[model samples]
Target: MLKFVKGHMESIEGIATYPMISLLIFFVFFALLFWWVFTASKRYVREMSELPLDENNQ
Candidate 1:
């Protein structure tokens, strides 16, 4: 099964670029998420963390 799939994939033109584009998208998404986590306000983080425990919201 693997051999057949690999052979079929190898016949397609521009298939190699798909993996590179997917990798770039994955890296950029995580990089932005990491940046946001670091730059987010402490107050906002604290509020979000306590949201589930806060009865007033219910």
Candidate 2:
């Protein structure tokens, strides 16, 4: 296990810093997506509520 870890660590040493930065970019993209979906869902629900007629109002 130690040998494997050392080997993998050595191989990844050059890219070790990049993975963290990439993860940050990934999270930022996902966060933007989540925010968009959240606001869009709110708009959708609001629009549906404003319909002229519905099962309850009838």
Candidate 3:
């Protein structure tokens, strides 16, 4: 059973590399997406979090 599965996997070109590449790509994409989303809504995020900018925050 294991050998059957292994033989199938070995037959596929770059199947092993696909996961590593996709994982790295996903992380990179997610990181960039989060950065963009955060920067785009930074003011809103801060306001929602109630983080006062001044000492006597309004």
Candidate 4:
């Protein structure tokens, strides 16, 4: 199965750039997410964290 997949991938033109583009997108998304998490307000984080417990109490 791995050999078949590799053969098909090797046959495709421009397939090499696809992996780089995918990796770039993944890295950028995670970097943005990390920035957001760190920059998010403490109050907002507390409120969001308590949301489930608040619902349970009510």
Candidate 5:
């Protein structure tokens, strides 16, 4: 089954670019997330972290 899929995929031109494009998208998404986490306000982060333990929240 793997051999058949690999053979079929190899026949398609530009299929190699698909993996590169997907990798670029994956990198960009995580980079933006890392930036957000670093730049987020400390107060907001504390509140969010405690939200689950706070029973007052409905």
Candidate 6:
């Protein structure tokens, strides 16, 4: 089953670029996430952190 799938995948056109495109997308997503985490406000982080413990949340 695996061999059949691999053979079919290898026959597709421009298949090599698929991995590169996927990697670029993955890298961009994490890069943006890292930037967001660092740029987020300390007050906002504290508020989110305490949300689960806040009694009024229920």
Runs with alpha carbons beyond 4 Å of true place in candidate 2: 1-14, 41-58
- Please write out the lDDT profile of model 2 over residues 18-51, one tens digit for every residue: 8899999999999999988777777787778777
Question: Candidate 1, residues 5-56: lDDT per residue as tens digits?
Answer: 9999999999999999999999999999999999999999999999999999
Pairwise lDDT winner, candidates 1 and 2:
1
Question: What is candidate 3's lDDT per residue for 2-53, written digit by digit as tens?
Answer: 9999999999987888899989999999999998886877678777577655
TM-score of 6: 0.85
TM-score of each: 0.89, 0.44, 0.50, 0.77, 0.86, 0.85
Q: Can you tell me which runs of candidate 3 are displaced by over 4 Å?
A: 1-3, 41-58
Q: 27 in model 2: Cα distance from truth in Å?
A: 0.6
lDDT of 6 by residue, 1-58 (tens): 9999999999999999989999999999999999999999999999999999999986
lDDT of 5 at 55: 93
**Of the candidates numbered 2 and 6, which has the greater TM-score value?**
6
Evaluate residue 23 in candidate 2 and report its C-alpha lDDT on the 0 to 100 scale. 97
> Number of clashes in every candidate structure?
0, 0, 0, 0, 0, 0
lDDT (CA) for every model shown? 0.98, 0.83, 0.84, 0.96, 0.99, 0.98
Question: Could you tell me which 10 consecutive residues in candidate 5 have the lowest summed lDDT?
Answer: 13-22
Model 3 residue pairs with clashes = none
TM-score of 5: 0.86
* lDDT for each residue of candidate 5 in 7-53, tens digit (9 for 90 to 100): 99999999999999999999999999999999999999999999999
Prediction 6 global C-alpha lDDT: 0.98
Model 2 root mean square deviation, Cα atoms: 6.1
Worst window of 10 by summed lDDT in candidate 4: 49-58
